[model samples]
Target: MKNLLIKLLHHNTRILQILLFFDLVILALHLTFGSTTPFFHLDFEQNLSTFYQSSKLIGFGMIFFLLGLSRQVKLEMKSFILPLALGLIFLGVDEWFQIHENIYRVFELFEWLRPSKVVEASMSMGYHSSLWILYYIPLFLIFAVWSGYWLRYFQSKLKTNVWVIIFSGLCFLTVLLMEILSSTGSYSGATYYWLVTVEELAEMLLASMLVFIGSKILSK
Candidate 1:
């Protein structure tokens, strides 16, 4: 167990450093501002927002890192790298600016720009239009373009890519499940706090995982 721990630490030293940096920042914020102050607030500069922003930034970095690696290896599927990087760049910007939410607001302002009557009626039937149009559609398009390239990359190097896949899955689960639950007010009191903590921690973990993946690619 001790040997395994030592090897794991040695292998993931960069990830550990990134995680430790965020941990200390969060800890310092909580200690200075009071315990509940950092957790319950939804301010733009709050801990939760910072975590979200950091995760997006890390994701942006990871895409470019992968692009560089693909170039270095002279990979055949290098054509997709620029698009993937651009998509991640947009994601990072959207994360910080809430661009999708702004799109919804813009549609709301111009009635003619809103969805059709059928779509609006469906939305009234507990169907979230934003879920379909705002998030799912864009993600589906991006994934559709990238999935085959990613599959080929993973097939060629399963062990190294597995960590990236796992962390990406975690980020997806946290955003799709935990964030949705929090938005829906599905938990209260302590449960809500715990949910928020888990969601933010997942974001942090995802960022760390991206750093680890970048390190792995660079090492190779």
Candidate 2:
């Protein structure tokens, strides 16, 4: 696996290029044809864009897992990367399986347990966006801690990649919070549709950037 990563880094840089190019395609297709064109699907469901994002996340999980084993990585870094690898894999599974979407259903059985604001917002969003964010608080805290460590770790060592990584983190975190916020306010069909499009696009680009950062670290 380590050898495979080395080969990928040595052989080409087109992988991320293709990712960004398709990201552009996603944008262009939306701008020209809009969501209802049937020429492409960007709905927040099982579709091309969703599958692409899931694949990138799962691929990153594998790469991070391999990095945890690489001789080049420090022992302490290995400790963090190993768990980070697992978290990424689980997130990939969540992406592919829609675990977050469904988990809210199970909890919804106990509406008494749901917060009032979450309950109110769920009624409006047509899905349990607030509850989803509510349940994710713990995980988000851990992610914050992990990101803080990553930021500190790379600040002095990988100066070149630090800003890229920071930008990626900010993009991701912003979109993360936007999940619930985007659901607020009655939007026109086009407005709501494009909002989701933008959020999902940010997710894909963040996944790509993280994968690029992981590859750079693996090479080091």
- Which digits, one per residue and each the tens of the lDDT, describe model 1 over residues 9-101? 345556656665875566446445634574524333434656555465646465454554543534553444445555556656665666755
Pairs with backbone N, CA or C atoms under 3 Å apart (clashes), candidate 1: none
Clashing pairs in 2: none
Q: Candidate 2, residues 1-220: lDDT per residue as tens digits? A: 6777776854224666777888888767766665566545565466666676777788778777986888877898787778777877887888878888766666656766555646676667576454667677788898888877876776665686566777787778767756766666556776767677777777778877766666665555
Instruction: Give me the overall lDDT of model 2.
Output: 0.71
lDDT measured at residue 120 in model 2 versus the true structure, 0 to 100:
75
Considering summed lDDT, which 10 consecutive residues are worst modelled in model 2? Answer: 7-16
In angstroms, how far off is 114's CA in candidate 1?
Answer: 2.1
Q: Which stretches in model 1 have alpha-carbon errors above 4 Å?
A: 1-17, 20-77, 106-136, 144-148, 160-164
Superposition TM-score, candidate 1 onto the true structure:
0.62
After best superposition, candidate 2 residue 76: deviation in angstroms? 1.6
